[model samples]
Target: MELNRTTCYIASLRSSSVSRGYRRIIKGFTAYADVCFREFGNHVKFWTTINEANVFTIGGYNDGTSPPGRCSNCSSGNSSTETYIVGHNLLLAHASVSRLYQQKYKDKQGGSVGFSLYAFEFIPQTSSSKDDEIAIQRAKDFFYSWILGPLTFGDYPDEMKRAVGSRLPIFSKEESEQVKGSSDFIGIMHYFPALVENIKLKPSLSRNTDFYSDMGVSLTYLGNFSGFGYDVFPWAMESVLEYIKQTYGNPPVYILENGTPMKPDLELQQKDTRRIEYLQAYIGAVLKAVRNGSDTRGYFV
Candidate 1:
């Protein structure tokens, strides 16, 4: 059987979903990607990072969804907090290999490599006043900061500094540069909108509540989680595309995933109308972004 490299998508070894208590699992698969450049120093053309690191918070951390199905490291409990650390460790592990490939094959022709990050959209509620700002920042602080800050700036988002305190790990200056330095493109896996507003911590889950669920703030409020709240706003997709373009210096972007889940209503088909519209709006944003000189190369919906 002839293998079609073009259609080949390799599982990432750096992520625990594939790494599974391993030492350098990806090393074995590089050959299959035909990543070898030269019998005599010739370089391979291109590469991409593991499937999508951004979904870890949602799947691995929050909902106990997908493989290795405990609520993830990014959650609030002692166990979940440890899981968040584990998640970061996994990210660093992946980053190490990403850097290794670039270093080992500097002379490669037309070489470009990157990874996908899932970005969840957020909208602040109107009635909450200034508390909404804190809520929005927390969400940004929780999700976007981890991937974006380090990938583009060589540091985790500063807001996380307060959250994790001394538990937060530090990178040496060299390592910091390495973390920020490795991207040739930004991979985006965006889906759905969220409404953020301050909510007082409930007594039963107060400490852990803020920890895992990341409550809006001290003020009283309510709003969206993945499926429950995405229906309210649709324009924010454009904001997300534009935000990426501006923040990441307009580096090329490949949207590796951007789909929504369907409601389980009887009338609905697996065709998932909400998911389809979600995709359409986001794709429209991508087009508008490209036309506006945003260097958005392509997207996979």
Candidate 2:
């Protein structure tokens, strides 16, 4: 609690929390940011406010797989509401922290604060099916636009609002203004791609549908994704960069994390030609995107 925020300071602090056993994000994150900047901003050049924000929220709040693990099927959770609420708080916290750095620390520290999300190159299940083609956009709305829409345009994707309905949180005018241009860069974490299939889920009488259900798309990954290494599809990286370029006005981007996982065998680890090829292919993809006019500033492996 102490590490998270200044919960102790606000004696009257009360959260209108919709998620079970979780208070709405209040002061802990920005307070922690302030401390980190005061102590380390002089040396740090890039500060990413959150890492893999979307995936983290969905895993923890909707899938019951991470910290504060809670979901509809768990002992206590409302996957329908908590995922959206938690994701909203993450955006709010990033905005607050970014604003703080810009106002109080930027002039003196010469540092940048950025926002991050895990990105997948979403493809249609069938190349010829119009429904599958459209489903790719729907998947992007939930996976990409859920974070970038507000950062770039000050609102959630219209599709998301229509689908999630009242469960999706709304940013007030002030929040919209604050979150719109809060980041110095858009950080992307990429490794693989997903094939998106449109699903017509029958209307549930109960209000317990999770984020995936709300998005109305199913994502299936290709390859042996159980840490044996990732399948290389460099074109997907180029496609992602292209989408961001056309959709979000070519914001400055950084590939914060991108790497293939390998099995834990010492012999294979030592003879790691696969990882080399992965890096080479992805780097080539980034170079291709750059040639095609993506404002991608950096990449990390």
Candidate 3:
């Protein structure tokens, strides 16, 4: 079971009562995880240490839209650097907790530990343009690899290192050893796909850049920016599963969150035909991915 919602770091960073740096945060979070493991490990066979690590770092540090509200122009926080710093600390913290579980509790408890990331199926805005196609991959590198790369391969993606330069955190030999192969499974929280359009790097790079600016791509959602409406696109789910299978050695995956939000209409909420159809289509897509050997193990909404 997933214990933390937006991750311990995000919550702690948001809390006005708590003010700590990355190292302190990691130490505190690892201790907290130890307590949870000691208390819940016997009954819970599957544990997710953090939820949406990528989104938390991005929304909180990069955009300053979430808790702590720190950005380049905000009252505090460095959008360009803090995101990577927090992300690096999270990877190390998650690895430490997973190692604790494996060494101390796995055999006795018969439980597994995993990490979760916010995932989006990105489609190129212009299918014919080679740059657009490449931008789609760059976006993935910035978004998915920002977290998954360290967990899977012990370092951030080469593309990310090149793009973010010194802003991206570095992993030492020991930290890399601890971070790699840290998870038994990966949890994905996907909603809808985003159309990725290639952008010129010179303009964004000439000025101060955040995560999206580093990726050199713009994400356009099909519907409103507000969370009130959604358009079901099951193909995006299938594509994301397939991409993960091909890119990440087909690790076990759990669909931790997938759903649509509707407005506060009592009659429509009672009926909810659209939501039902959305679920059915997405489940079908998951089945299709499994049939194609995606190694998807669980689904949650």
Candidate 4:
């Protein structure tokens, strides 16, 4: 698919309603996928239904940090529900495209359709405290399980359903069946890890409270969040892979994005010593993870 075009269409769909505009998104993507399959399926064995699906939803709808930005306090969009609504629609769209490929192209092309998301390693802010550890789990549920749980188990995580309450969309019987096992694999973009601190929900928080508020945890980004010349914790890569393997039934995995950015410098660009070391450590971690029986199939910088 032409990523730039599809992305613009998708990034704008959150403001749409399921009755009309949302279905258009589903049809639009299916139409695009059909074309891509016909044109590129023979050579492209692996197809990602969406790039960084989780981040796409969060950055656009909840945080208003990216294209078609929308948030609780933004000029439009309800951060509390739009994110989930858009995420739900994305899953449906993916499932539709996956079904289309499986029925029409998979046999001849021998290709696969997969979903991708952005992931970051999370550790307890207070290493010795169980609450912080539990907070980490909650954070994963809100982030990873929110998308993966449906793709794997045909439903959102129990924690998300409970936390988001009626704001979360429900999957119909057919939709649930379509969503479960639709992906042949999982793709992830992993960069840095974060220290997660447990937080209490404020009494004044409303139904329109944002996802971060609903998540009930705060992240202290390591390396000050820019990820340039910071500490390299390769073990976190292994940790992330292990968690996905264990939590999500060890599906075939690919590291679609992994690398640190560096400031502009001619010598630095030529040598790239820091990036070389960063990738070496992370790729080594992936190697160790594969050695330890992770179903990880590929890694990319």
lDDT tens digits, residues 36-152, model 3? 778877667778877888887787777888776777877887778888887788788889888888888888888778899988999889899899999999989988888888888
Candidate 2: lDDT of 252?
89
Encode model 4's per-residue lDDT on 1-301: one tens digit a residue: 4221122133544355432226677888799789988977776778888888888888888888886777877887788888888888889999999999999999997877889998889999998988999999999999899999999999998888888899889999999999999989898888789999998866785345778878888999787455446677899889999999999999999888887766788998778788788888998999999998899998987
Candidate 3 residue spans exceeding 4 A from truth: 1-10, 14-21, 203-205, 224-227, 264-270
In candidate 4, stretches whose alpha carbon ends up further than 4 angstroms from where it belongs are: 1-21, 205-208, 225-230
Itemize residue pairs with steric clashes in candidate 4. Answer: none
Candidate 2 per-residue C-alpha lDDT over 9-97 given as tens digits, one digit per residue, 9 for 90 to 100? 11112223425334335367688789988987776778888888888778877987876667889877778988898788778888988
Candidate 1's TM-score: 0.70
Tell me model 1's lDDT, rounded to 2 decimals: 0.57
- State model 3's lDDT: 0.82
Of 1 and 2, which scores higher on TM-score?
Answer: 2
Each model's TM-score? 0.70, 0.89, 0.91, 0.91
Model 3, poorest ten-residue lDDT window?
2-11
Regions of model 2 farther than 4 Å from truth: 1-24, 204-207, 264-271
Residue 64, candidate 2: Cα error in Å is 1.2
TM-score of 2: 0.89
lDDT score, candidate 1, position 244: 76
Provide the lDDT at 274 for model 4: 80
Best by lDDT: 4
